[model samples]
Target chain A: MYCVETDHLTYRFARNEPVVRNVHLQVPQGSIYGFLGQNGAGKTTTLRLILGLLKKQQGIITIFGKSFEEHRLQILREIGSLIESPSLYGHLTAVENLTIYQKIHQAPKNRIQEVLELVGLSGTGKKKAGQFSLGMKQRLGLAIALINKPSLLILDEPTNGLDPNGIIEMRELLKQLQREQGITILISSHLLAEIEKLVTHVGIINQGQLIFQGTLPELMSRREQSAGIVLNTSDSQRTMGVLEQLHLGGAVESSGVVLPFVQKEIVANIARELVRSDIAIYGIQQRTDDLETIFMNAIK
Target chain B: MHLLNIFQSEWLKRRRSLASWLVVIGGLFTPVIIFTMRMVYHQRLSLPQKFQLPDFWQVSWNQSWESMALFMLPMGIIMATGLMTQLEYKNNAWKQLHTTPQRMATIFCMKLLIILIMLVQVFVVFNAGLYLFGILPSLLLSSVSYPAADLPVAMIMQWNINFFLDCLPIVGLQYALGLHFKNFLVPFGAGFLLWIVSMSGLTWEYNYILPYSYTMLDYLVLAGRKIRIGTDIHVMSVMYFAVFIVGGYAVYIWKNEKG
Candidate 1:
């Protein structure tokens, strides 16, 4: 069974503008689902809807085969989350902050030390959370998310504002949590490259719509289908004009004009047309195999 | 979670917060001022021919209530509750708190109760400071003598209970305002404005209509300003508290954006 499931989830901030539209998400058990979207692309809004942070306007959200409305507390008891930035009391020490959540979850006292050690924060004694570095604060947030020993962990932009080292540490910690504790994690990020190495499944959102959701390999394999022919021309504007006249769909890029791979005769004809128009041709290449580039293009 | 666990969680959160300090400072401010003034003027009250609990307790109570009931009590509740409520928002912890296993009702009630408890702590400290103000005069000044009648424990306890009741609506009002606004000044400003409006109506025939006026009105009645109105300020305070507290919770539960 899927660990987290949603059906026809739709939400809008204003009446005319929908922030999330008809998103059906399935996060499998024991998998790191990468929720990818650019800023304001509704990734956070979708996660919030699932976590009951925002009221569900039109959707069915279920975790562990239980509806959120029927068993919200029970489902929430089995889940842990860190939305956007870390939410912490700056005045309290690391242990103290974790202790508050421990008491709230009624978790065992020893779990505090265990999770702290898991997050490499056991030595951060007597230091207030406000005094810790940004990376340290992120770890403490993860520790709080783990205090309940939850089976399903939901993190939105968990690695935001982290250095490369912090990102790698978070990736390793999340992997360890899944391998050791058998936890299912659904993590969101705006950049596919950041979570490419860690996620087993990927979901890409853009303009409040789920454009893609599949396994990482499945998403990566999409590069084969999106490969395009690149044209380096002197007068790019005239080249685009000729292509548009010929009903060729092309997008302007910094390197050159890129269009879907076409036959060699068609390319020669285009080159001839460009020459007739007094446009210099520098190079021609057919390549778009970079999955990051493909998805990043799709998201944009 | 059990009530004790929730209480412990809240207690630990405010360890180094402004609300905690407000309780301490707000409680002891009036008494410290009284103590300093007594020492400066070398004031001494002679033992009257007939000295009872009134002579000993009334002097301290009335003197303390002059400022407490008029300004400090209402304004202090406004500020303290604002600080306490803003603690979650200031640290961006409301989303964290909502994601927990606990129910929203439980959190709402426990958080509000914690603010009320903080107010009671202020009352307790202020009461204790009054006793200090009473005793320190005799110790610091050579001529002043200890009152012949002992401290009226039951009377002062009753007095505190009454004052606390009078302050409840203010607590409820500020608590509601604080929960609604993320900025601390919104509630403080609203409370201050309402208190001013409430004070201006003290002479009007329908002055008892305003909840903010209850604290000062109770004091006015105690100081022999007969209102001749049939309405009981204590009952009205309780009623207004119920309205604000319940209305606040209802809005909280019904609203979409919790965190």
Candidate 2:
């Protein structure tokens, strides 16, 4: 069963302008669903709607096989979220801040120490939250979300404004949570590269619409449809002529000769024809589009 | 149990806040200032045998209550409410709080309750300060004796209770303003302006409609008699409290949940 499902979800800040329009999301249980969208693409707004932070004007949201409106409290109890910036009491110490949430969640007192250690903030004794660095603040936010041991975690732009090392740490932490705890995570990011290695499934959104949703491999398969071949020959003009005789048309460019990549057997046939014609083969390579290129094309 | 947990959590959030300190200091301001001024006035009149101290306990109570009702209490309510709500806006914590499993009404009510608790603490501390200052000065002055026989404990308690009830409408209105505006200056300025207008030389009938004037109207000393209770003023105060508290919570829940 899907952990989170939204059907024709719609939202608007003003009367006439709809920020999210008929957007459907399918997040499988126990999968890291990466929500990809450009800035101002309604990714955060959609997350807010699913979390029940904003009232839904249209469509239905179901979580854990229950409608959002019917079981809001129960669903929310099982969910953890970090939206935009970390919500913290800057005047309070790191431990004090976590203690506040722990009391609210009615978790064990020891859970505060556990989450602080999990987020690598145990050593930050007596340091006020406001004095924490950006990366530290993000980690604390994640720690707060994990304090309840929630079944589902929703993080919007969690790695935004973090240094490279901080990003890697956050990525590893998320992976560990999914692998060890079997927790389902729904994370949103505009940079595909940031979440590419961590997410098992992806949903690309554009202009308040879900453009694509599927497994990582299914998204990668799109690149195969647009794949092509490149050959670096000793003699380009002669290679094009030899290809025409074989009923294969190609184009010669600065890199080499370009042709539509069809199958593995076609490469062998092209090689045999070039060797037979005494055109010394310098090199040949097949190129498939990367995920970033595929994402760009899909959004466009 | 759930509401208690929420209240405990809300208290923890402000355990170390500067607002708590400000409330203590603001509460002491009126009583301490009036006590010191009265001490100096008595010292200046030491030579005049004809200038006897006017009922010492009544004078002290009147001075403390007037300063508090006219200026300090209104400003304290405004500051307390502003400080309580500013924490949410400063850290953008409303979004975080809203997404929790707790009902929005529970959260809103818990916060308002905490603010009320803080105001009560201030009121108690201010009375304690007034009593201490009033007693110490009377012991030192030869001409002015503590009116222990004239001022009964029940009378003081009754006066404190009445003043607290009269301030409820101000609490509700300030809290509503604090929740509605993200900028502290706007609510603070509104409270200051309204307070000044309430204290101006407007018609006595205007006090019936103004929440800030309730405290001043509830108790008055005229012609050597203490008018400690006004039934009409108490009724109006209760009505204003119900309106603002219910209306403020409704608006808060609606805006936070939907807007």
Candidate 3:
């Protein structure tokens, strides 16, 4: 069953354009769903709507096999989230902060120590959360989210403002939550590289609309639809002419004849012709697509 | 049980906050001055005046309640409610709190309950401070004799209850403003503005109409200043408090964006 689902979710400010338009999210259970979007792309809005922080204007949100509207408290009890900034009281210490949530959630007092240790904030005794570094604060937020041992976790830009080491640490922690604790996480970030390392599923939102949603492999497979096959041979001009004669148009650049890549069979055919034409084949290379390129193309 | 949990959480949020300081400071402000001034002018007060009955407890209670009811009670209520209600917004934790498993109504009521409890705490401290002012002077000055009469427990408690009742409407109004606005200054500013209005209308015939004026009017009526409504002011104070507190809750619950 999907851990969280939204159907035709649409929200707009009064007398303004839609901030979140027609978003249908299907986050599978036990998967790290990366919610990718640029700043103000409604990623936060969508998360808020699903958490019932923002009243639904037009949509249906279901969490843990129950309707969010009808069973908001029940759904919320099993979910944990940190939207926008890390919502923390600067005056309280790390344990004090988590204790507040613990009492409210009625979780065991020991869970506070467990989450603090899990977040590597065990040594931060009596230091107010306001004095914490940005990375520390982010971890503290994660600790609070895990205080109740939630089944589903939603985090907005969890790796934001973190150094490389902090990012990796956070990524590993999220992976541990999903793998060891069997928690489902939906983490939103503008950095695909950040999310790419940990997300099992992916959703891309642009201009307040969800443009792409699928598994990581499904997103990776989209690259095959367009790639350039470069053939470097002893006689590049001859290879281009022969390719043009074959009606498989090719452009001859300084590298060689660049052919439009379609499939393995097409590449095999080109190699077979190159050998028949007596052109000494030096190398054949296909340009790979990066995630940024895929993300940009998806938005377009 | 959940209410207690929320209450504990709410109190934790207030730890080391200015609202907590305001309670202690506001509660002690008048009594401290009363104690200090009496100690400084001990020679002059050695001879009791015509108003001094056998028991000086009444005098001490009057002096304590005089400034408190006229100014500090309402102002303290305004400031405390404003500070307590704006805790989430100030910390940027409203969204975090809103996402918790608790219902919105429960959150609203628990926060209100915390603020009200703080108000009670301030009264507790102030009452202690007044008692100190009452008994401490007899020990220091040789000319001043300890009162022959026992501490008028019933009268003191009655006055405490009445004064608390008088200040409820201010709490309600300020709490409403506190919920509606994110800035502490908005509620603080609006409260001060209403306070000025209440002060100006002190001698007016219909001063009772203003909920903010109840504290002062109750004080004035007790101090022998004639006002139109000599009836019980607690009822009026309570009625206004009910309206404002319920109105604040409705505004809070019905809000589209809780954070």
Best by TM-score: 1
Candidate 3 lDDT score at position B76: 86
State which candidate, 2 or 3, has the greater lDDT: 3
- Residues B140-192, model 2: lDDT tens digits: 77776654435546767887777888788888888888888889999899888
lDDT of each: 0.86, 0.82, 0.86
DockQ-based class of model 2:
acceptable
Clash number for every model?
A: 0, 0, 0
Question: Model 1 off-target regions past 4 Å?
Answer: A235-255, A259-300, B43-54
Query: For residues A1-300, could you state the per-residue lDDT of candidate 1 as single tens digits?
Result: 899999989999857789998999999999999998878889999998888889888989988988998999899889999998888999999999999999988999999999999989999889999998888888899999999999999999899778999899899989988999899999999877789999999888888988888999988777656778899999788899999888898988897999987899999898898888888999989875554566565665
Per-model TM-score versus the true fold? 0.90, 0.85, 0.89
Q: List model 1 lDDT by residue over B25-116, tens digit each.
A: 88888999977876775534332322224466666777788798999889888988888888899889988898887888888898888888
TM-score of 3: 0.89
Candidate 2 C-alpha lDDT tens digits along A1-300: 999999999999868688898988999999999998888889999999998888789999999989999999999888989999999899998898888788888889999999999999999999999999989999999999998999999999999779999899999999999999999999999887789889999998888988889998887677666577888999999999988887887889787998877677988999999999999998888864654456556866
Across residues B136-163, which tens digit of lDDT does each residue of candidate 3 receive?
A: 7777766666666678889888877888
Q: Which ten residues in a row have the lowest lDDT in candidate 1 chain A?
A: A288-297
Candidate 2, DockQ to 2 decimals? Answer: 0.48
Say which docking band candidate 1 falls in: medium
C-alpha-based local distance difference test score of model 2: 0.82
Kindly report which residue stretches of model 3 are placed more than 4 angstroms away from their true locations once superposed.
A224-292, B47-55
